[model samples]
Target: MSQGYAIELYFDPALENQVLKAWNVLARRQISTQLIEIEARPHITLLSSPSLEPLKLEGVVRAFAARQEPVPLSFFAVGSFPVDNNVLFLAPKANMALLQLHSQLCDAMRKEGVDVGEEFRPESWTPYCTVAQDVPKTRMAEGFCVLRDLKLPVTGYGVDIGLVEFPPVREVFSYVLGNPVEG
Candidate 1:
């Protein structure tokens, strides 16, 4: 657990709660509790890099956040990174608005001398909010079964953006976007 940092887009509470529900189910069943243990809120990581400097990047994130509108997202499918550690996630429907937002954020970071690398670049990014991580290979199907019980297509807007440092997660900064959270 290295002290890595990320710029994340957080959901409005409604959407956040829905994502939490998936996490809760997995935890209750002993399937996965990685996010719960880390106390991570439901967020789509916009960019991640260890080279991030919180003090210098605050203004960059705030200014970039101010320039943007809330990005509408529909988590229409459930999937995972086909990687060794086994991550399960809710896949947001990729739309031009989301891609452009990611591109602009990356461009802003580059201007500040932070290269977010190829994985986060708009052309290669697959936008998903993680639900469970580090499940055993044999239990992957059980995790999927629990997630399938979730309502498909959790729809909402990403309303806030922030920077967090983690191992033990900590919020460095956050700014609500142009479209505010609706009750």
Candidate 2:
């Protein structure tokens, strides 16, 4: 089986923490069943590639970092893919700069022999944060209702991109590219 790697765009420090807090509250209230579990960090995927040659990985990160520009993104509604058994958060508003960055990164990855799935096509893309997974239909509805009732804040800011890897059958491994910036 092929290993998975995701190049993702994330919110800045403050916003990331806030989103986490909100998600934790929602999870505690609505997610008590065994059929669903919310895992994975909050992020908007730029590309999901099966594999990258070791040498090419650094180049990919550098290419993405060089083009980095901060942009604001907002989360407004909660939604779900009932058939797929997943719950997603919706960002009712998006920044063009952020979308452009995703596009450019896709183009760059294609040039590097990465086969990004068609699902990521620009026109079909819907920017969202994944809040829960393996959600049954009943829980999905309940979760959506919970999010709908809450006045979720719209968090926004510029954030650095990250590369996450899953080696073989093990769980995901993540690396934050570039030097750490002082707060």
Candidate 3:
């Protein structure tokens, strides 16, 4: 019964729909991954912490959201970690704006005493939208085919910061990014 929150970037509705379609196709092909809950939405995780109170976590996200605006992110490639061939993902190209936001949020969370772990820190994080997880090694080639043909241009803005509970991974609340200059 472990619980935690993740700060994630969500895609536009149209792009989201397409990504869902791909996930369905892969599942139908018998290459489903873990964490395939139907309620889970497509997102890129920016930060996660296993030890923060929900109400306080909400405040942290609110303060972090105030300093950001919708950020344009390009999904330019597909990549997988060799250490864990079980997962496949869409990689977002490097953008200074996105990186800075991640850094700022991580810093803010740390300042507030959230023990954001090492992997999620800006320096060690790899920005990606996971398409599948827990893939069987025997199905690796089949998964690769799905990824190869899954290529499509995806460009959109991450317009809101959402706090998602893990395990079941449900959205608790969302804060639309607003201009910091107005704050």
Candidate 4:
């Protein structure tokens, strides 16, 4: 059975290593990712929708990824919003580049006959990479503590994009942004 699909933003491996370090700390604290339920990776979720046909999804992703440039992102703070701010996450500061890519991708997906979900639309999206979800309120402070000294306000480029299935996310295709990183 195919897991549902989502459009996710993946960063350069170096930056991903940093985020995973924080996630490992969270897991050690006994904070469970029970809600998300997969051996999750660190990523910024751009869209989550029911599973689309693999070939169609791949074609859309290829076209979308090819025309898109790498998006620069800044993680400003650790935050939460799982069914009443219950999940803990890394919050990226909102910027025009991120917003525009989201809008464009959603539009393109819709035109390609994919029913892009409403929650992922430009009006309702809240961009974040979850660290842990479904934690007890009593442990919220502890969760934040795990990420406290993680080089906050970090800057990185979203260098890769993928279309994936959720619950147990499996990637259909991933496209690396071909733009060069500036020194």
Candidate 5:
């Protein structure tokens, strides 16, 4: 375990269940079960850094969350990062609202003297919700085939934000951005 934290945007319950179905399917097939093993929630990470101190970060997040409203999300495609370790993800359409929320959260974290990761910077971010990670190159093709048949264009609202720690994944705190209307 390491002292790391991330700011995560989570969708409403129904959307979360839909995503969970994919996670469960992948886990059962023995493709990649790292996420479920670690017990991570379905979320888009806004910013993450091991240097972040939770005490200071929580206030900024609570205040920021209070000021924001539900973020509309559309997961239009399955995506992945090009690295040997690999990551399979759900790609949310980077609409104006989602971009602004990401920007504001980054700025807030910075103002609180938190060191934000450069890759999470607004201009650099590629808003995605991870599905499976640490998948072997040999099996990635199978992972894709599994997910491709699942679905795309999942629409929902990002209703909550949280501060989380990893290596078994613990949620320090979470707040509802606003009242999200369930579809």
Candidate 6:
């Protein structure tokens, strides 16, 4: 069977910690069958496609790294996809550079014959940091109660990107594509 791969924009560890902290608080108050533990690195998915050869992946990452410059992003309010009632997320304040990067990445992936979901396409997208998934309605309400009262911190410059692999039946492995940001 073919493996699954996801090209995602990972948050620096500091920002990830904050998101985890919030998620932990919500998990404690919820009773849901969904996976509540925060395992994968916090990220805003750029694209997820079928597994590609290592060389192809390297080329894709290199191309993205070369064309895309780092940009600043801020986290704002908390929101939910009411229909799914399965995700609780932190919103990102509007940033044109981020949007443009998203668009460019999608375009690049398409040129390579990758099918990025129409629902996740640029124009209709709302950038967010997902905190929890598969949350039960009651728990979701409780999570909202807590998230609504809290103030989430924004990562001033979250420009790092990463490539992650999720095998058909194994743990996910992630690799950072660039150097760690200098303090």
Q: Report the number of the highest-lDDT candidate.
A: 1
Off by over 4 Å in 3: 33-35, 83-85, 179-183
Candidate 5 or 2, higher TM-score: 5
**Least well predicted 10-residue stretch by lDDT in candidate 5:** 174-183
For candidate 6, the clash count comes to 0
**Candidate 1 regions off by >4 Å?**
179-183
lDDT (Cα, tens digit) per residue for candidate 4, span 52-89: 77677776777678778888888889987658657888
lDDT (10s digit) by residue, model 2, range 1-183:
546777767677777776676577666876532212324456777777677554566656665665465667777666666456565565646668767877877787778877768877676676777665565656666777766765665667646676766543222433343444333
Backbone clash count for every predicted candidate, in the order shown: 0, 0, 0, 1, 0, 0
TM-score of each candidate structure, all chains considered together: 0.94, 0.78, 0.88, 0.88, 0.94, 0.78
What does candidate 6 score on TM?
Answer: 0.78
- Report the candidate with higher TM-score, 2 versus 3: 3
Candidate 4 lowest-lDDT run of ten: 174-183
Q: Which residues of candidate 6, in runs, are more than 4 Å off?
A: 1-4, 31-38, 50-55, 167-183
In model 4, which runs have C-alpha deviations exceeding 4 angstroms? Answer: 33-37, 82-85, 179-183
If the candidates were sorted by their TM-score against the true structure, best first, what order would they fall in?
Answer: 1, 5, 3, 4, 6, 2
> How many pairs in model 1 have backbone atoms within 3 A of each other, for residues 3 or more apart or on separate chains, i.e. clashes?
0
Clashes of 4: 1
How do the candidates rank by lDDT, highest first?
1, 5, 4, 3, 6, 2
lDDT of 5 by residue, 33-150 (tens): 9999888999999998887788877777887888899999999898889887789988989999999999999888788877677799888988999999999888898998888887
Checking candidate 4 for backbone clashes, the offending pairs are 4-165
Residue-level lDDT of model 3, residues 1-183, one tens digit each, is 647778788877766776687688778887974545647788889987776577877776877788788888888777788876578888888799889888888888888888778898888988988888878888877877887786566778887888888778778888888835243
After superposition, which runs of candidate 2 have C-alpha atoms over 4 Å from their true positions? 1-3, 30-39, 167-183
